[model samples]
Target: MSAQVIAIDAMGGDFGPRSIVQASLACLSATPSLHLTLVGQPSLLEELLSGQSAADRARLTIMPASEVVTMDEKPAQALRGKPDSSMRVALELLRDGKAQACVSAGNTGALMALSRFVLKTLPGIDRPAMVAAIPTQKGYCQLLDLGANVDCSAEHLLQFAVMGSVAAQTLGIARPRVALLNIGTEDIKGNQQVKLAATLLQAARGIHYVGFVEGDGLYRGEADVVVCDGFVGNILLKSSEGLAAMIAARIEALFRKNLASRAVGALALPLMKRLQADLAPARHNGASFLGLQGIVVKSHGSAGVQGFQSAISRALIEIQENLPERLHGRLGDLLS
Candidate 1:
């Protein structure tokens, strides 16, 4: 097999090439077979790489491009006008077969728009969806349509269920239980769209559809695959992020209340580590934009060095696992 390479949109995140460059070095050190091509302004990317050892610098190739698509720029305007933007250039590398996957922490709308416009979707997949692996009590849960298609149809949700199930399985879950998100567990719950989606999932072949799952059911380990339109999924993801931060802050406050509490906190260091590990977004840093011709991992824009490193490793795993090939094989007929 050919060596798997990833094209990173170096100019695309809150920290830009600094984080991406640090991540590229970490990923290369961890996996020898993977190569990285950083797409951004040569001068800036080179500056980030300047301090690295010569051997480390040899592993990366910088592709110079001046333009950058801002988080606030509309996708259409960026795509049409800024042809050399890092985001667009990264996707182009994937399209041209120079990279196995593309990763960006840029504007979600621009990434999705550029990808769909350039790579298109697999047949029978009406709309591509954003899928993220969120930490759960039991393990990881794959949540789909996280801000891709806000206004979705029943068919779209069904497709998301299928994609999410496949993704969860790829992550080591066997026969992942799929759940449609709704207001309640009753068969009659949810709006017309969700009700219809639940029905479709139940009737869909090759998946373990477990009926509707409420938002509150996520931490309870109700399902391995959770399906919802992007609007709801986005809201749920952001809310969970906020909640996790709040919980961590509360834990810190409690630990600082008194000497007794500080002693107890010291005693619970191991437990705290486990809890922190479970909630770390870096563990689940990669989220595949499903239905695209190739794998595209989108990390959070504000991801730090560790998170960016995790994103690179996750992308390498996707490449090594032949994620796109497996998806194409399993969903080929359905997509056709």
Candidate 2:
């Protein structure tokens, strides 16, 4: 396969270009077929790149961007005032075909707005949804509309199911079982919107809709893809992340309680590390903006080097599988 070129909004995240530069270099060393274009202040990026080996630097390019969209800025304001922002520049690169994918740990609203303006949506998609992988008992479950659309109709929910199912297939699931996120698993449960979505999903072709799944079913691996409106999905994602962090902190507190506990901790150190790795938010930091004509991966704004790298990896996988193209074809067939 040919090399995949990716553009990164180097100034987007909390750590600015420092973390992004380090992660980009690391990704280049790890993947021989990967090339990166870092978009940010040229001076800052150059300072960060200082002392890097020539060969490693060969695979990386810098595109100077004058402004940055702050995390708190409104999406409309940023779009109108900061055309030269790193986030916007990176998306422009994708639009121009200079990069196969773009990754950003920036303002979610601004990123989504800019991406929609620059890349547009696939033919049958009215809006692009945020889709992400959530760790589950069996392995992982794909969930969609994670804070993109605050209000969604039944048709929107059905669209999320279709897009999510296509994404699961790209991730190696042959026939993914799909489900609606509802209050109960019964045939007549949830709000009217969810109930209506269920009807559409059951009749939709090219998707394996298996009915409704509750919040608990998400972690139980009861279904491969869980569909919900952005309002509910965003709340669920934040709550899950917060719970994971609390559990990890409590575990550490327990181990540090006394000398006796410390000794016990030593014995269980390996198991604890494994659990931490699996539950760490950084490991699953990337979320894809599905239904866009081009691939865009949204890294958590506060992500560190490791987290940003995970986002890059997510983009690479989507690019390799030609996710957008596959989704377009599938939706076309289903609609036809």
Candidate 3:
């Protein structure tokens, strides 16, 4: 029998199960083999699932979960105390071979912590990294260790490169060129971590390490995979988010200024749509917690229906491609 792709942790993210359930239903209609098991309290999921077609009702199954790990809750505290939490339950399904993959938009720290506690890592993986897809002039780029490990060693950075390379290949790149994020393009630049990581990456086999890459060089299509510590990556991700929002707000203000400006807005709408489409976060919704035994996609906390759908769709693609086994074969030695 074919594997089932069900969404666990129904009550996660800002939108919660309303958006999640809606997206899961939409995904079921779009993909036949995809079945949805919304893991949450029956009351909440039943409310969300109301007014749906019999077909959708048939495709979805609700498993009772008593607790939810909130965004503010600490990961360690939640894991120890909240035994029936939705995230934990969802992960258990994956571990027990009942679910092929899981997607969550909850507290990232909690998700990572729970994933580690419940799913554990594949052999030789010291730590798992969060990889998010970012827009670039050359289409898209994947940045790793978004918030998985705040502090990393040289070996961890090299693993990020290997994992990122596999991810880039999955996205259609032949052999993703990796660039260690640093203060300068020089080999000896940046802090001790980058310097040490650069040496290791340059000497590493089966990866294309294109030397050091400065912050400003990221968007210029300098490399397909940008490797850095989680702290730096999180800051970079937030900064780009702020920049995109600021630019969008400025454009909206300009369009409302005057009659001529409004007319100009109409003329510029197509170009704006093109740019928006190119940089839309919803287009790249699935960021894998790399090095896990099975796929665990994390969507943005504020992800709406579209972003949630993209996350589910991406999960399906990853499973269909056997991304985990492929990466293991490629980086097994280095991970060892």
Candidate 4:
């Protein structure tokens, strides 16, 4: 089999090129069949890559980009003003078929806008939704519209369900139990949009519509795929992350409260580390902009080396599974 090539926007995120370069080298070392093209200012990228072994360096290439899309930049302004930004350049590589997929920790709005403009949406998809894997009691659940489309119609919600189901299947879930996010599990709950979407989902050909799931039900693993509008999904994701961080912080504080606590902490350090690893946002940093013609994974803007590496790994998996192609085929039947 041929090597899989991925383009990375090295100039993006809070840590800039260093974290991205570090992750790239690590990924290349771990996956012998992986080739990476790091896109950013050539000088800075070269400086960061200076310490790598020649063999490791050989598996990577640098693509120069003069501009960068800042975290606060407006999506429209960034698209028009920064044509040569690292984010845009990376997407171009995918557009031109030079790379199988692209990964970026840039401005989410700008990334989505540039991706749609460059790669376009799939045939039956009117808009792309941000989908991610969220840790749940039974393992994880795939959730969608996580801040991509703030306002969506019933049709849009139905589309998100189809796309989310396909994504779950790609990740090894067969005939995923799909559900609509709402205030209650009752069929009579939710507003017009969600209720209408529920009806459409039940009538949809391929999916296994499992009715509604409340906010608390998400972590309980009530469904394998959960669909919601971007407005609700974003708040849910952020709130969950914030709650996890607070719990982790409180645990650390309790452990350091006194001598006895400190001793106990030392004894329980291994268990704590394992729990922390399982709950770290870094482990789930990547979110796919589903319905795009090509694969694009968005890392959190403040992600570090390990977080960004997780994003790159996500793109690689989607590329290998040919997610776009599968989504396209499944969408035809679902939308029909």
Candidate 5:
């Protein structure tokens, strides 16, 4: 196995360092070739790992970071006010080539701002967009511009499609079918931005542009990659998350309604559990900040150990794929 290093912003999330440390340890144990650097308050990190065996921690290291980026903090404040923040330090490690990628369950806006500031966008790219694997009926679809660029140009939407295509390929789709998320599937349906992006995508090379896909089509896995402006994508993702939770809750409530219902639920419990797991949004937690010069994955801020571990796994996949390098190589063909 090839050696791979990933830096973790241990202090950035809602649950803080404890969950990050646990996820790091779980990932370390699972990936023998993985080396992790936890960037946070050294004391807390050390204490977190104090109970683990030497064998478990053989490839782990702690990098000191005195500050943490709060969930509600403004992006600009996190950028300038906290130079030594765990999020910034973790990105610095990736920038300096100390790690193959960086994983953070950090404030999304702050993560985007700090990453753009520290790593800069790749040549030929205006800004980086966040892409995540959203679960679909057939499997999963790669959705992009997840809260990074709320306002985007037609050109920016084209760029997101290309980036999302690359990410979809990394996740094992050889020729990812890229689509622009629109109000309707018809050519005449969307705003000027959607129409312009569709024209660009249809003409673009190095991607399989399948034209427009609506929200329902997206959930049905009609396309491998779905591109949208951050405003729409973020709302879609959050609403999907909320809907999943509500459905699961309603099912559970149905089961608990009466003893007869509870008995029936007991008989169906295993299948329901599987379905719940499949529907849980946090089951797919990491979103890559595509178009960055380095690999940076943003995890859900409230992710627990399992969710954060999935984020780490996402980073591992990107590292192995050398995603940023691939994006740089393919940009000219897709963007030109």
Candidate 6:
């Protein structure tokens, strides 16, 4: 395969540029043929990498970005005001073919807006939706429209289902089981939009429609791709992350409450860590913007080095798989 290049918004996430810079250096060290272009204040990015060897710096590029869109900035405001923002510049690299993919941990709304404006959407796609992998007992499932479009019609949900199915397919599932996220699994338990979406999915060609899957069913790995509006999907994703953290903390607290428990905890610490790593949200950090003409991934704003690296890894995988091309090719058949 040819060498791969990815552009990163080094100033976008919650953590300072130090963490993003570390992750970028780590990725460069690990992948011999990979190149990174860090879009931010060139001087700060260079200073952060001042200690690196010349070889590492040779493969790295610092693209100057004068402004930054804050994590809480409104999408419209950022779009109108921050033309040279790190997030927008990184995406411009992808749009101009300077890089194969772009990754940003910036404001979700702004990233979505800029990506749509810069990269545009694939033909036949009304809007691009965000899809991220969520851990499941069977393995992992792809959930889409994660905080993209707050309100979606039945047709939009159907489009999300198709895009999500292609995502699963790119991950090597020949025929991914697709399902709609609903309060109840029964046909009669959801709102009209979901019910209508179900009807459309059932009739769509080349999709393995699996009917409705409740929220808990997601953890059970009942479906490979779950479709829902951005409002519900975002809430579900955040709630799941919060719940996992709480459960882990509770377990840790239980073990430290007494001497005997502490002794047992010491014995089980290795196993606990393995389990935690398996289900950690950081392990699946990047969320892809499907239906776009180019590859764009959104990392969690609060992600640390590991999470940010995982986001870059996501962009790598999509680049290798030619994700946007695959989605464009498959949309015609699936929706027809």
Candidate 6: which pairs clash? none
Error of 6 at 55 (Å): 1.3
lDDT, model 4, position 324: 98
Off by over 4 Å in 2: 266-283
Per-residue CA lDDT of model 3 for 1-336, tens digit only, reads 375765568888888889988888888888888887789989978987889889777778898889999989998988898999889899888888888888887888899999988988766678999887787777778888887899998888888899999988988899898999888886667888888888888778888889887777888889999999898988887777667767767887789887678878877766655555445443347678888888888877787888888889888888887788888887876655
lDDT of 4 by residue, 1-336 (tens): 579999999898887888889889999999999999999999988888787789989889999999999989999998999989999999999999989999999899999999999999999899999998887889889888889899999999999999999999989998899999999988889999999999999899979999999988988999999999999998887777677667767777888887678877876676655555445443445889999999999988777888888999988899989999999999998898
Candidate 3 local Cα displacement, residue 212, angstroms:
1.2
User: How do all models score by TM-score?
Assistant: 0.93, 0.95, 0.94, 0.95, 0.95, 0.95
What does the lDDT come to for candidate 1?
0.82
For model 2, residues 229-322, the per-residue Cα lDDT tens digits are 9999889888776776677677778888876888778776666555544454434458899999999999888778888999999999999999
Cα displacement (Å) at residue 298, model 6: 1.1
lDDT of 5 by residue, 172-204 (tens): 889988889999987789999989988888788
Clashing pairs in 4: none
Query: lDDT per model, in order?
Result: 0.82, 0.89, 0.82, 0.89, 0.87, 0.88
Residue pairs in collision within model 1: none
lDDT value, candidate 6, whole model: 0.88
Task: Supply every candidate's count of residue pairs whose N, Cα or C atoms clash at under 3 angstroms.
Answer: 0, 0, 0, 0, 0, 0
Q: What is the lDDT of residue 292 in candidate 5?
A: 91
TM-score of 3: 0.94
RMSD of each: 2.1, 1.7, 2.0, 1.7, 1.7, 1.7
Q: Is candidate 1 or candidate 5 better by TM-score?
A: 5
